[model samples]
Target: MTEPGGGGRTGWVAPLCWSAVALEGFDLVVLGVVLPSLLDEPAWGLTPATASLVSTAGLLGVMVGALSAGPLADLLGRRRAMLATVVSFSVLTLLCAVATGPWTFGALRFLAGLGLGGVLPVALAMVNEYGRSGRGGSATTALMTGYHVGAVATSLLGILLIPVWGWRAMFVAGALPALVLVPLLARYLPDSRPQPPPATGAARSRNPVAQLVRDGYLRSSVAFWVASFMGLLLVYGLNTWLPEIMRAAGYGLGAALAQLLVLNIGAIAGLLVAGRVADRTGVRAATPAWFAGGALFLALLAVPLPGAGIYLSVLLAGVFVFSAQVLVYAHVSQHYPDHARASALGAASGIGRLGAISGPLLGGGLLSAGLAYPWGFFAFAAVAALGAVAVLAVPRAVPARAR
Candidate 1:
């Protein structure tokens, strides 16, 4: 099939979209990286409570942005929307470096969250549309690897830059990539064709949100939302609290931290494997299987294992846990019509942010009660099981046009 842009240069889409996603991933972890330094500064008078408020504010903005960006993308072209979001967030993130107080910092974070939230759905939509036919699963999973790459890079940067330069430098570094990324997007990103008007007067009056429920999509839409919620819950819950939870389970701090790294490494491996399998066997089969594998591994972590056994379990858990969510995204991209694709993706992502917020709270609650070890694993296992069941409810068949 011909590429989205002429002259067979569609290669640019994946790299460009991957870079955009990496920026979002950088933002995702930057707060965690900088929070310690912020607390150390006596002048800011930053408290844990205020820090929580700032974090929550950014997430809430992301949720709102995710909810809004899809329909906006469907109405406006993807290239335009993508450029606007990137510029908006980059400028706001740069400003975060210079904020005077907690309130100012948090306000900037919230503003940046709006752009960060918009990036994923739009990028996913762009890659899916531009990619070769029948490879949506591979294309999406490949694009998402940039997320982990960005995250890992930020962690390393935090270790290196924070001690030498300070926390403010991190935000400036995060924003600097946009200087290169935005211009390339403007010059190379192809504009998707405008969505045609709905046929009937009634259809024309119905909004994109309403259309998700009106057609044969009601069941699948709800299923995707449920699956997304559970998927992100496992993701955020584990990432936020795994080290502490392992420490609670009697592991040393070094080992616990090492396991966290193992988990993400497993995630990258999983993305690589899951996408190809999904493309060959179909996302309908692969998504639930991955979730089930995640459930099994999470449950095994509850059992006391030898040192290597524990690392192996965490690694396997990471493999299934992370990619399972991305497969849900692959399914959404393959199932929805061109008009509703971005909207559906945005809704799933927006709703999933609630799970992201809830995951850390759940982990914190479990830790406070001294139940974070076995109970935490058990709880995450149950959530993974639910994700599997939720994906099963989506019909096996997608529309021919979507295929």
Candidate 2:
């Protein structure tokens, strides 16, 4: 009997790594949920603008962390890198509960972001290695489903606990995985790294990241980075401003908020649908199709249809926009050999964070200029279409050798 991750290994590693991804998701949602209370307290001095800065601060740290993860994962094995990152973020998240002011809170979140940003690529690499028969799409999509699950769980916790225990307790909840997951991962997860053939010896031990763009991989590598940029830009932009965008279009506040919930529900449903399709159709084909669908659904949002029609559009947009990006991750995992896999993912994810930062900023800018609604939605549709074009630029065949 053979295993997908490696021979003679139990199926425990993927779940352990996935739990780390979920922890980051939980920690992320906690910040979003807690910010309102922080603003109301006044002691924190969290103006909406300052709160946005705090958000960007964490994202910047995540960008740095993500950029570094690939190199570090290449230097240290994936399991070790994953463990260190999970511990780093979880411990820092606990520190967030004790912060004295907005600056301190923002600083802690920034530091925690380093750990949060670093883990996903490593985890995705592990899951991709664990699965077999080039099922990168199904495996990665299945793993990312844990992210939304973690996000929804934190949203529920915010509602239940923040009112009683307050926001600090919520951060504390985000920290619990350190105690449970770190040990579980150490015990259960097998190390994943590429095996350098004996022929190369000392010569082959060059930078893994440099291998991504040399020879046959340059075109695909650039295309993947650009596609990831567009995908995440759409994701963060819409998640941050969707409610506000809808309200600007004249929908009631309650309906706008309800649409967010519907969107996330659609995201969860889309992940399952996409995983199966990507597994069969191949990520190269499926990812672009999803993004194309996202563009259409998003463009339809500008029309202000009746209640059911609007809900359907929101749901469909949610389905395509988020999963389309994850499909790219699937493609990357399948594209690179095992050794360079984490580095490739980390680079792409790091670049995508730029888009994440831009999305909210772009929407906020448009809102300030009174151009948010049709223009914002139109811009989002255009970006999704651009992502599809980027995907199409990926080379049909990339050399299998690690350069």
Candidate 3:
């Protein structure tokens, strides 16, 4: 039988942790889906450059949040840290609906990004703690499925609500879950075990970057960061530009959007399959292979093929593209000690945010240059290949219990 605080509780822990990530996913993609609506508003007067700036600002804020939250969670406890982040982002997102101009909107997005950034690491830590030994990969995969689920929900919202209620309504809708989950988290969530109670009762020093560079960990930390950078670049870039890329490949709008749906469906399936596969094999064994497959499939993304062939390739690419990066996060949890778990996750995510920032901008540049489809697929393929190498070289840093 499972103890009260044992891994069995991961069922609840994983879902609760996902609530925050779900909110992030919802907020992240909803902006893209709603951009057309924003452009139609004369009051906003948003140029493409101005709109891009707003996105950049939000991404910068997310990187800051991801980098900073590690230590804070280390000091404050994961549950409380996550709750604070959720509340902060939720309120700020609501405030976004009321913003009057481009500047205000961009500023609000940046502020919201802070909350968005921090919540992910904290939630990740919670799931890792409750996860069974040797099951860290599966645990993280399960939690991150929430991200794709959130994205799926936003797409549905765009179809159902955007036509009637409009874009601002999307932000308002994003706020509801935070309000609902905040109280539930406060009531039911358990604290992560403290990190050795901060030596001699002195104030805690919780810098993830600094700690990661310390004795015996520097090489692994750098490897993971490199892997994260490439993995997320492929993820964000593909999601941002897939429709445009597909269109350039001669698919109609209906087909392009259908590809998006297909991609995410494959993503959901990949997450479930990856968790099970990684649990049976090893995260170390599975991640590099997945990234390699992602690279191969992405390379074929823009090649003209028969309808059935295109569908199968896109589905396969989605499976590997989304899940390969997730496996990276899973590996981080398994490799790190409990005390540094959140920090490790935070650092990987924080660094990965750089790629997130670059992905869309690069895709847009390619589109403007009229090299849209082939360039995007080719670039993503290269990044995926790099990810394969970076992850393949990861030393057997798995923790004793995790192994």
Candidate 4:
């Protein structure tokens, strides 16, 4: 890693990147939060079927955006790519407030997701590139904490504002990140990726995507994608279904929602702890353990535990579920060369979007088809177990300095 100039510039990277991702989290959860309000308005005529389609549309856009971003961020500067995406997302988000119908709202969300999807890989790449030596894993994990924080904030806003000011106003509030965060990123976010002198001729011009699978990296690259897929599947599934599953398991609606809150609280705590541990013990070592622990906690949720036991299990579940996925990102950033990091992370996440899209659908199907509360946990556990095996399968390679 290139030596950073001072603490001030280094400090801003995390917070600024975190804030950008937080906006993604906010936009992500706000749609779910406001869906009920949209449904309530007969004028909008949004049935569950149509709403599901709308949600999938946005995710489809995310997958497309994520896959496309790697090349741009690699060819362009990370800061410039991130800036363009953040601006587009913020503007589109503001436009969401003015959407009059399901089609229009869904179209806006799909467009905004283009921006949202691009930001994460670039942000992860930025954090990884700027991080100290072996701490790339830790720094990337630390940056992801912003995503969950944004989710929590959106939840609170939905509870407070969606009831009073209505759904459109809540979407309007999503635009504040642009006004507040864009300036900080524009001013301080480094245009430089940890430089180590320039390459010569064709080496400098090779595409990031093609670079990822070259030089005996194909196996590890594939493994990271598989691991990410399973991890994200678990994450999106639980986040979408946890409340309803808890409600089915006999908790009241309020308590079920509160348990979801506890889960995110645990996720935040896990990020703090996991990043440090991964840095200390290597992401390759820590990731499997995390996935195994996540699977175990999920299985624990399947048993008919007491209320406190349930809450504790949920908290522990959060601890492993989300960060395990992030460690995959960490693993990518750590394993690949600087030139390949953004593309590697982007491809992994972009492919993993399939799982993200499937997760909610899987949960909804389980919930609708019966055996939701009990069986859903088991399914998540199974997926997490697979994630463990996938990560363990990655062939260790010497880090390259192609950049």
Candidate 5:
């Protein structure tokens, strides 16, 4: 690890990267947690559809941010970009807490989404660069695990704090981590050395996204985008509606809420483990199997199984759901050279953000139509199977060093 500042502990880098990802996780989940409270507030005047629209807007902002942040990070350097994104989202979230009306809240969330979108790719790039070469998959997975941790924490906080303090408190709580951590990030994070342009010369160096389309990379890129779409679709869908799903499946409200916790715990473990396993056996080999298992698990949930089966299904779903998308990212980082890595990651995430938006909408549509719980799980399973096959179809590229 070439310590950008000085070297005592490159160890701190992975943890900091994880912390940054945790903030992104918080931003995504907190709104869902606080939604019921927000709807009940006369001041906000949120109808169910309106509230859903607001959530969709945030996803759109995230997509825009994801697509744009990579080139910006490459131009700006990773450390400055990551810290700036953290501070930017923090301030926007604070604004969200203070805003009184729907318009203001939506606008703030959109801006916050920009910050939220930018942080992930930059963080992933940094971690991938600093992490031991053989352990890139595991290191990236560990960093991403923080996102699940934040999501789980926010869910608990919402259950505990909202009865006393209301939805604003949740946003306020969200802001605190960034405020405390931004300074630490500002001081400690190291910027990876941006790779110089390809020696093929200035003519070919124009657009990084365009570069990805050349050299047979177009196939891999499309496969990743499809896989990411399915992965995030499952993630956001479950987070948005798991409680309701559980309640419909005959669990009490308390048990329904607890299942979310159990699911995220599995996610955390999956992130920590998936990378190491992928590193040992190519990311290509590891990811398809994970998705297939996830598909089966999600399908199993739809059956009116015993209590143990429900918990087991959720735990297993969490294992594959979150890590599967991240493994796509690791594959991109490993597949692309550094100069284009961020851009590729960003594009894939940007595309996947579209899927993220759809997940909630799909869930709401299914639930509104009174589709059986099994159909929903079956649908998610289909998505997973599609993603697995999509990933498998793309021809694997040999690393240049190996080539």
Candidate 6:
């Protein structure tokens, strides 16, 4: 069957998918934005340890959502899955505004995380399926720029809203966009056609996860998982704690939050650049190079710099750090067959959430020890280097048809 919006009429696909990803991006940085305020609220009794636990709870939910959503989307249809996820998360996020305690808030976050986690792979698969032929790299990165666009907006909103309206306002604001977004999705988003049956009868019966490790795909699958873990470690660790880290480094809260804003702004710029470069140089070469650049910039963040110098450093770090993770998704989409593409992306994202969980814990631990500044940057830099090395192991080849 011909896919809906195929034949190069995918205008709706990009905007709807991009908007879905933007919501996920809002969740990505919202907690970090409100974290400092939460800590200051005496009634909640939140400490670094508890905050990390809350963050972990949310990430754990995301991991489960990602792992299950891929197969579910493959079975039920992407349009239905996307709409369900958006509604589920938006309602849960709105409830977060009324959470009575940290545990209650954490529970809501975990519940909302389930929907947030599912959005990425599902939206990604849809975009790739309907995207311009042979521009998978650009297509993937372009969609992801919405991720940072939302994040950048959240950071700015936090700065403006949190102080005046309080921390709960951020959650309320995060969910409100979905009201407009969901209607657009339900009205315009088209369901993707199911993948054709496998060539062999035996292969046809096998599930998406099994197809990942079979047929000479084990090495690439394993490599993608490892690289994704490290990439997300950097992405989540910094987004969740960079403002606090900057605070620990002696900057005021406003300046620290501004740094977070700068970081994602740089991420938007990086995503735009990385896509074109990856498309031109080949994702295989470009992915590793971006990770390596991320490592270098992350390590540079350890150095103490003057005001302008520090913002520039954070911007550079954002440029390389965030897009490095998205490139992994681009690479996976190009390497895998359509039959198992969402499954592969989901598995990679789900496994990467483990690193996402660890990222906050790592930062929380460092902050608790009063070593968040130099040490956190060093630790994050090492993870980026590992990401570079892991992707290097995934043999330099895209499927013939994919290319």
Evaluated with lDDT, which candidate comes out highest? 1
Can you write out model 5's per-residue Cα lDDT over 231-251, one digit (the tens) per residue? 899888887788887777778
When summed lDDT is taken over every stretch of 10 residues in candidate 5, the lowest stretch is 1-10
Q: Taking the tens digit of each residue's C-alpha lDDT, what string does model 6 give over 97-155?
A: 99999999999999998998899999998888888887888999999988877877898
Stretches off by above 4 angstroms in model 4 are 1-8, 193-205, 398-403
Give TM-scores for every candidate, taking all chains together and pairing residue i with residue i: 0.95, 0.95, 0.92, 0.92, 0.92, 0.88
After aligning candidate 3 to the native by TM-score, how far in Å is the CA of 170 from where it should be?
1.5
List the lowest-lDDT window of 10 residues for candidate 6. Answer: 1-10
TM value for model 1: 0.95
Error of 4 at 354 (Å): 1.0
Give the alpha carbon lDDT tens digit for every residue of 1-403 in model 1: 1224322245677898999999999987999999999999899999999999999999999988898888788777677788889999999999999999999999999999999999999989989988999899999999999999999899999999999999999999999999999989887887764464456445542356665675567888999999999999999999999999999999999999999999999999999999999999988899999999999999999999985999999999999999999999999988877877778889999999999899999999999999998999999999999999999999876543223
The global C-alpha lDDT for each of the candidates, from Candidate 1 onward, is 0.89, 0.85, 0.83, 0.84, 0.82, 0.87
Candidate 4 C-alpha RMSD relative to the actual structure: 2.8
lDDT of 2 by residue, 108-220 (tens): 98999999899989888888877877677888998998888899999999999999998899889999868988877777777665653345543443567776776477788
Which RMSD does model 1 reach against the true structure? Answer: 2.4
Model 3 whole-model lDDT (C-alpha atoms): 0.83
Better of 2 and 4 by lDDT: 2
Please list all clashing residue pairs in model 1, or write none if there are none: none
Clashes by residue pair, model 2: 5-130
Q: Which stretches of candidate 2 lie over 4 Å from their true place?
A: 1-8, 197-205, 399-403
Candidate 2 structure, TM-score to reference: 0.95
Give the candidate number with the greatest TM-score: 1
**lDDT tens digits by residue: candidate 4, 1-403:** 4333322276677778888999888877888888889999888899989998889888888887788887688776677778888999889989999998999989998998898889999999888876788897679878998888888899899889877899988878998769978877777887744332355544532667877676567788888899989988988888889999988888899998888888888888888889999989999999999999999999999898874988899899999998999999999888876766777888998899999988988998998998887898999999999999999998866445433
